[model samples]
Target: MKTIYVTAIFIFMAVTVFAQGGPPATPIDGGLSFLLAAGGAYGAKKLMDRRKNK
Candidate 1:
């Protein structure tokens, strides 16, 4: 039981230290591309649903 508690505490501290290293920056171009892709998917789904109902 004591061993398990120590292991858990060590793991938690390691994760906390690693997480403090901030993530890389995101690209603005990628955001625009993602938005376009999502919009296209939504439009295609709507078209498909409209056709199915007809």
Candidate 2:
């Protein structure tokens, strides 16, 4: 469990680094939105699969 938590935190930090932009006016909204949507869709699919298995 400790290892899992550590890995999760590391992954989150890594993603934040890529999400950052150097330009003052740079926009990350588009990619961020896509990532959120994709994450939601993936969670929904996993939930559906879990239900089906049970």
Each model's TM-score, in the order given?
0.50, 0.55
Looking at candidate 2, the ten consecutive residues that score lowest on lDDT are 19-28
What would the per-residue lDDT of candidate 1 be over residues 1-54, giving only the tens digit for each residue? 999999999999999998795778877998899999999999999999999999
Where model 1 places Cα greater than 4 Å from the true spot, the runs are 1-27
Tens digits of per-residue lDDT for model 2, 1-54: 999999999999999999998767878899999999999999999999999999
Q: In model 1, what is the error at residue 11, expressed in angstroms? A: 54
